[model samples]
Target: MKKLILLLLTAILALGCTACAARPYTPAGEPTGNAALDEQVLALLQELCDPKADLVTNLGAVYDFLCTGITYRATLADTSGGFTDELTDSLALELLQKRKGNCDAQAALTAVLLRRMGCEAQIVQGTFLRADDPEPVDHAWVYAVVNGTDCWFDPLYGGHFAENPRDYFMADDSRMALTHQWDAAAD
Candidate 1:
């Protein structure tokens, strides 16, 4: 009886340690607080990639879905007096319903989706210059750490602007800096 009790305690301790080790890092971004909307987003993610897929594969699926599945709209939501300066729950839901939005919406959706998918992600607000435009314009993109690799995903640039769409996925800081300007220390 004494030996059996010791074995059970050891097993329990091992399981507890495994759980702690497997816990993912605390990710950024806040939830919409709407259960239904959150479910819709998760459902969309499920539709995009298999639940059992690897992190990188899942991230790729999300990028592809955002770029191709949703149309780009060049308008930013007016959030001056609303819940926050950044993307709100209502705005994110509207993006889903309308299937179009500016860079903010794309980046927000990417961040939220990544957070739900068990990856560390954050929405990055910055400025970008188009080759045809002389002035830099406000833009938003996503930075995510996937499978121990720091990567950047730009849905708008990748889908709409880049000559090669794949260039924006998993991009390094130097490559992204060519067109995008942001505070390196902030992120």
Candidate 2:
């Protein structure tokens, strides 16, 4: 009985240690605060408000607000590691603070702000065909159900919509294919 008790205690301790180690890190280089953060962001958005703030107009306003407010910089290997799979609002702030982020950060910030304004928004991972490239480049963007039609907005590309954003909504098709990996589905 004593041996069994000891084994159970050991297992519990091991599990506890694992859970502690697995805690997510707040993204580096961003200010993280509960009240202050919300206030700051809300104030910024309010400044750009239109009296007719419907989903389409509000989302466009927010997208333009972020794109214009935050300057874009390239991702650093050591800091952001080129891309962050966990693209939360805090992570977006971190990237914004550094003035650098990949497509993921841009999409994340856009998605979060849209959601706050009661828009149905989602982050989409996919490839984009740049002007010089025959092949599509790996990219992330926000898809919003705007006016009963799905529209894709790429904040990384100055908040432009893709040619056919609804193409991703085909049967058995997924937005995950646009990402380099399938793990973005978890976000």
Candidate 3:
């Protein structure tokens, strides 16, 4: 009985030590401000300058520009406090100014910029499953009509339909089951 008790205590101590030794997962990569990117976007928009510019083109340009300029940082905690579904335009602008926010912040900022540019854009609430994730995680992205087709954009992913081409977003109607649609009309 003494030997059995010793063995059990030893096992428990070993397990606890192992758990304590384990390190929390940290995502790699540093945040790149990409100043050149801002210049490029400004130039693009300037070229498309018109009293009434095309909505699709303007929105697409802004989305692509933002995605290229910003780097994904997973350090942001889930700050969706009291936000039932989406953030308001003012909140989105505040996040943009801060330059450090979660996926929802990126989506909100993109939507607001696109809207200001005279493009109809909206925030898409859904689940994004990483290749390793067996189940999807709650996520948010932006979608806007470009050239008569709905184009989905994710700044967190940081790609312009190329380089970081997303298999999920590429689908014609691919959307997560938990997707909640928020729009100006609903407000």
Better of 1 and 3 by lDDT: 1
lDDT (0 to 1) per candidate? 0.75, 0.54, 0.52
**Which residue segments of model 3 deviate by more than 4 Å?**
1-57, 73-86, 158-162, 165-171, 174-187
TM-scores, all candidates, are: 0.75, 0.55, 0.50
As a TM-score, model 3 comes out at 0.50
Note each model's CA RMSD in angstroms: 8.4, 17.5, 20.3
Q: What does the lDDT come to for candidate 3?
A: 0.52
Model 1: CA > 4 A from native: 1-32, 79-86
Runs with alpha carbons beyond 4 Å of true place in candidate 2: 1-36, 76-86, 95-99, 159-187
Model 2 poorest ten-residue lDDT run: 23-32
Q: After superposition, how far is residue 152 of candidate 2 from its true place, in Å?
A: 1.4
Candidate 1, residue 47: Cα displacement in angstroms equals 0.9
**Model 1, 70-174: lDDT tens per residue?**
887765575333235235565667677788888877777777777777778777778899888999987888888877788798988899889887789878888
Among these predictions, the greatest TM-score belongs to 1
Q: Compared with the true structure, what per-residue lDDT tens digits does model 3 show for residues 74-183?
A: 53435455233233443454455555566776776666555445445567766655555577667677676544566666666545223443432422444422232334
Q: Which candidate wins on lDDT?
A: 1
Ranking by lDDT: 1, 2, 3
**Candidate 1 vs. true structure, TM-score:** 0.75
